[model samples]
Target chain A: MVLYLIGLGLADEQDITLKGLRAVQSCSKVYLESYTSILLVDDFKARMEALYGQPVTLAHRETVELEADEILRGAHEGNVAFLVVGDPLSATTHSDLILRARHYQAPGAEAPTPVPVKIIHNASITTALGSSGLAGYNFGQTVSIPFWTDDWRPDSWLARIGENMGLGLHTLCLSDIKVREQSIEDMSRGVLRYQPPRYMLLPQLISQLLAAAREHQVDFLDPERTLAVALCRMGAEESATRRGELVRAGTLAEMLACTEPDEAQRRQDEQDDEAFEEANPTVSEKEMDARREARRVQRAIDFWGEPLHSLV
Target chain B: MVLYLIGLGLADEQDITLKGLRAVQSCSKVYLESYTSILLVDDFKARMEALYGQPVTLAHRETVELEADEILRGAHEGNVAFLVVGDPLSATTHSDLILRARHYQAPGAEAPTPVPVKIIHNASITTALGSSGLAGYNFGQTVSIPFWTDDWRPDSWLARIGENMGLGLHTLCLSDIKVREQSIEDMSRGVLRYQPPRYMLLPQLISQLLAAAREHQVDFLDPERTLAVALCRMGAEESATRRGELVRAGTLAEMLACTEPDEAQRRQDEQDDEAFEEANPTVSEKEMDARREARRVQRAIDFWGEPLHSLV
Candidate 1:
């Protein structure tokens, strides 16, 4: 049995490679890995359906974990393609699945596992950072900042950024996202609670970073000296914007102060969040925290300066 | 005069979004940032010309550093666009450029620096990793391992990876790419030493990691217990493959064993390098050493487990 894994790059469904498209066409069944990251738009299923003239099954996190054997059951009978968002093997879960398939295929074989698993590579954020004109080699560390509670907020990202600064290497801070669900009331009742599924923004991130910097007394950052770029709506045509700027006291304060929810925009955003929450009630609190942080960061940046960071 | 900054996702001129495409089309001039990362295929100028139906200026590292005023000179005169791979502002260089533009625009409000800068986002590797089925949040710190040298091999990557592992987070290791350079020997003789440019491969990275693990006694990696994924030929339709298996003693040993080079492939690779070296000969010896170490690692992996990494 042959297994074909395909990556759907950022943006819409069409970001997939021609090779991946063909694999999807030829495969008897297709499964889209849903959960890790998401396309800016949710019409990927419709787009792929139109492009491939076939239906695709959505593979949620749980399905991928429990239905591995089922997913591959028909691979031996025909061809099966697993559709991923970016590069197929970039994540360990996919790798684990591939390993599982190999194990199943070679149950009792003395020779190495013989099933052929093919991967269709797509652009990943790692490679995408190169677009920023940053020396790929000069990047110190990539860190993700999750949503934190007043009591349990973690300061790991600060250490990471500090380390990067120490080495004069840049840091790629991946904003967080919340895909699952948690009740706001329940969260509020606890020491820390998430309101809804959210994508972290730049403002929230800056606030956290500033607080951490103060707590640690790491003068590694001078709001004016430390530069930051905030990106939102990645992968879509209207992929929102990327703003770069110095995170200084005035700028940071302005960003945080501007978080007065835009009545109209906030309404729309909340509606979108509600829809998502309704559809996926089991979204974890951790994911929500990450998304919130991402949104906060984005908001902060937008408020501090226009989408583009001010050059000295 | 707003500057529209857009990220062209991956390969193919059409990889741009409708909005981004329109922004480029409307702009009187477009600058393509070419140094940070490159597309798997498609020449920059050719692709931009075909897509925008206009001449596209190339912005190499030097142009970005020396010609900032020139690049932003006509922003107020007409629409101008800066083309970046992946997403704009992903790198600090672009951010700095944007900041500079903003500064000029902020002064004396004579049409606000003539050009208003706008950033158009696209699918970046950061968000794209979600497609890999790896929890984006699960990833801890990312580090780049440059081509090392016998005289000064850096084991920083080992420390970074170890820290990530200690936190049970995955580490994304970016390999090095020598874009422009001369031969090492020529430089020694006061002649321009031009060596072919190169990109680090999976095998080289693995070897170095193995060496570092062994040397540092990083107990986190069991060779067999350590899980690693290599991506080759990223963003190409036929370029992605993944190799994953238990890192066993036999596998490591097999990887370290020698194998004959495919002369034809080697020659072709060298030819590509020669062309790049001819144009730019000031290659760093440190980079070369890192590349060599990476190559050795690649050889081991290729010989050992049939190259479990992927090329896209």
Candidate 2:
């Protein structure tokens, strides 16, 4: 039985290639690596299930990292396929799986074992970033922007971006994604509580970048003079402005600022436990207005007439 | 009617996605952008034709650059698909086509008009280079090595690699390809004679690199110490190597040196403009022996190999 590692490209399930879909359809077991990146679309699981005509077991971080033996055992029984976003093996975990699958032996056997493994390549954000009309070759090392905690904030990635800038090359920044994480207290309480999934928004990223620039004395970036393109849901139906003026940075900052609790809300925090109504994850009026105003400005710059994309 | 810019991925026709194939099947015109890169498989046109179930026209630089108006004109009639190897818009010409296709109008039009354009992203070398187990973000600006001319030899790309090395990053050096090139004399004579297609081999690349290191005083690339990976035919069925040692530099130089004219051959060249056997492109015995020895060494080093490929 062959072990197939397939890439489902960017966007929805339809992004899977004819070659990849064939592999998936023929597999006895299909798994989707879901913790790294997101399709950012509704009904993603249902849509994928409908297209594959098979139930896909969504593999979270712990499952992917710790349950390889079980996955390989399934492959031992019949052909098993793992679906990854972007290219099949960009993540080291996937590559390690491929390498491990090659040497996997039956549970109680001692003889050497080999199951043929194949990989299907697809468009990754590394390549999809080309849609921004920037030369791929000009990009230096990419960086990630994680949500900052109160005490620890690292600016190491910014240094690399500055180095790339020094050489007149572009940087393809990968936004940080947090899926199935737990708050420190939640983890210690043994309650199995999970934090809400979070994807770093562009505004938060820009704010962190601005802070890094100021702290690191990275002269390349000045809020008023520096130009940067904040991309989200690239190559999808709805894409952000291909090019941008730094003015959007102001709007984005305001929008993010508006997401913060007001003085009244902060004062009320000590009075009661969170209520269902207060816990609703909806934007405030001012934040909504800020977002609308930002998009309103972006609408003027989207010359490509791409499909509508919400800048989340 | 929409103008679709589809990426054919790497390798052969089978690499085309289901989405791309459906788009091409629905198109009235399909043009393969052949000048930028190659599928590298034999009988590529026939293979693509058999797969697409429609005629595919191979587009050269002259046709793509000079007769773009004619292509956009076809988009006016019905859906037209322009097929590109790797991602569609990585090359400026292809991107220009997308932008131009947007503004194209019917033949005797007066005011500005808009034509729909959709880009289908696929795996390009920029992303496929990840097969080497190197981080995509760690890659600095990529550079292409062109066939050298006697009067001009540019080492600008080497400097970029040096800068990347300074930042502890990797460099993806793309080898140059020459398809349907013309000699200077042929151009002046207005003759349509074409030169044979040339794909740069590793030996040639190393020769140039060594020269560049010395001439440009590149301190980073020490022939004895600096290691590099030689990759070829990425994302293909018969990928040469997931990665190969640049340590083959010594063997390649030796093998290339063995191909030089011997004393007898050099002496005979003075007496005749050309000889029947002298015009042969076959390798000399010494060159063959050196090649075998190199292969022997490579056999020990090629851990992730499927097939033998020229280094350049």
Instruction: Give me the candidate number with maximum TM-score.
Output: 2
DockQ of each: 0.13, 0.56
Q: For residues B1-312, what per-residue lDDT tens digits would candidate 1 score against the true structure?
A: 767777776444555655677778898988888776666553657866976899998887778888877777767667888888766765666777776777665334665553466766555555444434566646655666777765778887787777667656667666666655555667678884446556665556667778888888878766555655444333434324533332222333343333335789678766756775676688676765566556655665565433122211
What fraction of the true Cα-Cα contacts (under 8 Å, chains A to B) does candidate 2 also have? 0.60
For every candidate, how close is chain A to the native chain A in TM-score? 0.71, 0.77
TM-score between candidate 2 and the true structure: 0.80
> How do the predictions measure up, each by TM-score?
0.55, 0.80
Q: Which regions of candidate 2 fall more than 4 Å away from where they truly are?
A: A238-312, B238-312
Per-residue lDDT for A1-312 in model 2, tens only? 888888888776777777789889999999999887766457788988998999999988888779988888888889898999878766666777877887889878898576777777888777666676677767777776677877889888888878888888777766677888988998888878778876565555667788988888878866666656545565566425232211122343453443444688655643432342256557476665565545533433342122221221
